[model samples]
Target: MLAPLLSDPDTVRAADEIHRGLHALGVRDPHVQAAIAELPLEDAAAARALGRRLTRTGTSTLTVNVGIALLARLGEPEDVPYLKVLGLLRALTRPVVGALTALDCPTAALVWLADHAEIRALRHLIDAIAARDDHEARTWLINAPLDSGAVGPSTARRVAEAVQLSDILGAEQTDTQAVAQAVAQAGRLLSRMTGLRDYRPEILSYRQATTTYTAFVARAGQLPPTPDHYAILLSVALDLHSGPSVLLDWQPGQREALLHALEAVLHNESWTAVAESEPEDPAERRRVHWLRRTARQPFHRATVSRFRVEATVRDPADPDTVEARVLIDGRPLVPEAFGKGPANSPEYLLDSGRLRAAAEPREVQLAEAYCTEGCCGALYVTICREGDQVVWRDWRRPPSRQPRAELPEYRFDAGDYDAEIERAENDRTWAWPARNTARLIAAGLREQPGLLTRWDGQVGWIGTDFHDQDSTAISFTYWPGLAAGQRDKDGPWLQFVWSLPDDGTPPEHQAATALRQLAERDPKTYAQVRGGSRSHAEVLGFPWPEPEDPEVTT
Candidate 1:
């Protein structure tokens, strides 16, 4: 009966019958144990029988070990579920991970095991995957939920270490998809850990840091070009201004390599071109132009700081007029006149003006005092005066040769613009025509920090202490575009203020504030000082103030 059961073509059924018979004969019986151990493990029938015996309540450690060894040796991918159950019960050991690896377990299975498995077991699984040292295994490891903080710190550390090691190997692998996957995974991890949401910069740097991009580009270049390749290259160029991150530490020769890759992508005549030549499609032309511009600029680490417009005041004598003043890094910005001008000449007068005039305020203009080729252009504001006070009503770009139909008609409210700026800063993809729109907004604020008035279509100049700094602010009154009947209401005009903060604010703001004071007290010399031409410390005539650690303030 035992021989017939063992010899049956149905391996699972035979194993079950043998297990029942062995149970009836007493599992602890040395004869029964010997019989189970002696069964041929190479055959599916014998291996199932051993597995059944090992799972039984009274199975000995020696029998369990033997069963696991046989299963590891003979298990097919289908057998992984059963082996995993046993693995969970016995603690996921090296042998179990090795068996799973051998079975070519899917990533889902490994992840499921990770979710249910003990920490030690998970670490061993990570090691097992890393040990495979191939693209698929490395890709799986790259996407593992190690940073989810579900695991203890020690385990997370081990997993991170394993991934880093695997990444080094993954970077060297010839698989393009796998390498891209690794780069994306590393980028995501770095962004999450650093509280940064944009990973384009890091993704672009992967080729330089890991050689993954280099490998991918070489393989991709050999194939028929796809839109995906164009997109990849474009992404690299567009994000060139983004600084390096922990995972994508820039290295020597990386920038040059990136430029070469851009050129290679451009070499595909169907996608982009050099010199005066351009793609026929306007959108394609724009894309190529953006790429070229980004490549030319590259990434320059600039310390940006934030400032706020603390107040907009009416000149005591002029009720319809207001003067703009900004508090940057906690100091007031007063414009200083430069060039060949006496103390109160037009050049000096241009440095300050009436924010509004005594008329029905319809429009206001703000011009940058230093209108050089490199400087940003002017800002225009529209306004309406309420009883006893004035309020900024709306913002419109200065008229240009571009057809009014081509210009966007949306009037920007200061409140909305402030919110949008904040959103754009956090999410680079916040709006269509994102970077350009942001650039225009920033330029308007930087170049024209003061307000001038337009009454009956004629322009009138106004003055404010608004001036240049590492940071500055702008204020505008919003018009809701109400009906004629609704125009005479309680809140016809709303004032909104916005500030551009340094990359790290408050501290930078304070430093900027100090510098502003230094510049203002000695305008003759400091008026000529430009931010990039000299160090802030040298220009300020003192050591550059360090951002306070822990950032305490008065």
Candidate 2:
């Protein structure tokens, strides 16, 4: 494709003019790559000059892409500097990264460019770093795996594999700083590897995760309690409690030993003091509060039952929603196990009628259709507390749904089930503004269900909507209509919108106001709402009325 351009003695050789010529000639990437691959030595030198010139001076992305592709095939190490410069343009990251990798770029230059590269286009850079036996690259990966924000938990495994994390952890010559950094990185890595995020690999992906965690616990005891160390330890501790089944990948005693070690360090008086003080960093503060809110519980297996259950907050942005997954004998009981769709939202599972054991066997909805629940039906398993055991049996789907074969029943240690539920419930690290409002309102209703008696409704689902730039509208969905206290098979739904200021007003205070408003207001006076309509609290004359002036008679 470039034969005519390379041979023309009178052709304008300026980078822009050449770029324009290439565009005019309708040259494509494959044509350019093919022509560069077959070019003669003298012609290759001229092409390299053209590639270098265009890469350095061209403003158009198409021209720069062609320049970088040429360099990737025929350029030398001397071109790494300019390639690194061009890597800054996120638009040109992929082509520039490829070019830099092909030129045998210095490890430092590669690392610098990788820092600026997007995670989606970072595999080549990571592989380039991994290919070299460079200590610098290994150290960088250990200390600051997530620092650049170039890679998230989803892509961190690539970084872990690139550094040969398992080899480093098992090596006899690994130094203290490297081990410590590895421990910290591994904690963050494992914490995310749990089934919380879709497409993220589980902790089993890393063979040495168990060792790194144990090492982290040991290192924590040796160092003075700090926000960073405490945060890492606390996060990993929560993950151990509620993440995927550890015994599936860990040795028999390893899970207990690591959990015990973590408990010791996390609950140490000195560490507790630091955590209680509430560190300034937002992330650390969230991590530390989990321990602050819950009592210290022992990490031990109560019964020999093989059932393990965990509530996963798959969507942190929607914190009020969660899903429950079970592992029997270290094997997942997922939707795919029975040809179902996905798991149902377990947000209301803790309401004494779902996963929480009850005196009578309760048929709980476990998994549901990927589409609407009514259309494709849901999966149900009967759960009940039988003495020291939490038994799950009679696995079936919605009436007439497939899977005619009866699935096996499971009996979990009641102690283990309760502990896991508590851990998952207390995990407020995923909390946000909307969830906070919902949580407070839910707590208030739980404390006083009769508060909505005047309205003749029960809270169904609580959510929030953007009211304005500085405030939000807390919405509550109630069942069986309002006022008349009527009931039917399906029942009707009503919504109340409470607009609250974002001026740091306590959520509990908002909850209190909402409760009081619900108790005092006559739902009959409010306009009937249908579809997506909502009754605004301010319009209903109940928005935290201002204090009245006290009389001097007092």
Candidate 3:
């Protein structure tokens, strides 16, 4: 009876009814389970039917559980996409979770589900991974794509950290010495992974963007009233700040909805103060906020400003030769010295060391100028003059080394002075948050010294600082031999210090204290550090300690 129903495409309902009756009879029927499990994994219809029956309104709980167990045992990776569709039904939650857990390779299934499953189902997968408290699960969770409509980066990071902490705590209970050694090693691994520095302006931007997105979406009726819709909107908004062209095909209303959402999201007392200080139009005020946020994004930081091509000089030797001395806001536009122009004209001089009077004066604009302090000193633009109005074209970075003429151009009017200045101002705001995030992480580590002692490479190292300068100094001594390249030099230990701002002084001290505790608690790491290289220590601003004798107990 089961064989005929299973083989015939039209007998799905009959097969399900018979299976349900068997389930009702307390027949933990191996034959039925075997028949279901033998169905072709590629058969989406069969999988969907089983999945639907698992959640059917009148299905017995035992039947659903039985179906889940069978699916878990037999479902192939190929069945995942269809299963994901079934996973969307709230009624199937228990069975779906069971099936996911039962898969031979649950990690791959979870990842695929996270990417394609509905938000609730994705969350279920995340929760399941978090509960497992294992390295492979944590790593997969950490590497899972957060760009999916279901999960945002901030949430993903939090989940990863939680799972990491759980794993660390679990390990610490079993073996203190081993966990301590792992923690010390994790510090070194994390330092290398993030270039031995803690401060990340990009992370600050991500946090800020996520905050703004959450706030705006909470109040904005424009987005669909679902958590998944909110997550997607937030991701889309962040993408917009980085690159506006991604949303070029969106309706004006949609773009404005996002921008308006960002506006509400980023509005703060400081912005209010800035607005109050300026006598600008409401439209300009909004543009200022947009520009300010965009400036923080690496993709949108290339700024365009209005300029007047005061004079053009044509080399008498060549008719096609042209040079222009541009004025930005009535000031002579002097390109940065040693600045390389765009790749199209690498050595092309935008401003001659000395000014040349223009034979032909026309208003123009410059786009993609070095707007940030650490600019690579390049000027890229599409300058156009229409009558008395000068319009600067939005300059997109070329995909490859392409000639200037081949670069794509889009219209960007320079009439929005307020917006341009806002972007320029935002370029200077990155340092504060970068410093603060580092301090916050450091402070957390200081409070929980045990956390460092339990660090496993499987869990992320969140408190490691990225770079240090001497202007403000916080120092720690650690055996340099523990670090990757420092094992061969004549040093028992190396002192690592970072120069932070006056405001960062306390956190830097706290970080140093935490490092000291880490070094003292982990003898294995201490032994490795004792053998570190002299040169590596010197680079980190520490004189190498005296070389350790091979037999010395100290």
* Global lDDT of model 1: 0.39
Candidate 3 global lDDT: 0.39
> Which candidate leads the pack in TM-score?
2
Model 1 segments more than 4 A misplaced: 1-195, 198-224, 238-242, 245-254, 273-554
TM-score of each: 0.26, 0.62, 0.26
**Candidate achieving the largest lDDT:** 2
What is the C-alpha local distance difference test score of each model? Answer: 0.39, 0.59, 0.39
Rank candidates, lDDT, best first.
Answer: 2, 1, 3
Give the worst 10-residue stretch by lDDT in candidate 1.
Answer: 452-461
State the displacement of the C-alpha of residue 193, model 2, in Å, after optimal TM-score superposition.
Answer: 3.4
| Order of the predicted models by TM-score, top scorer first | 2, 1, 3
Mark the 10 consecutive residues where model 3 has the least summed lDDT: 313-322
> Lowest lDDT 10-mer window, candidate 2?
545-554
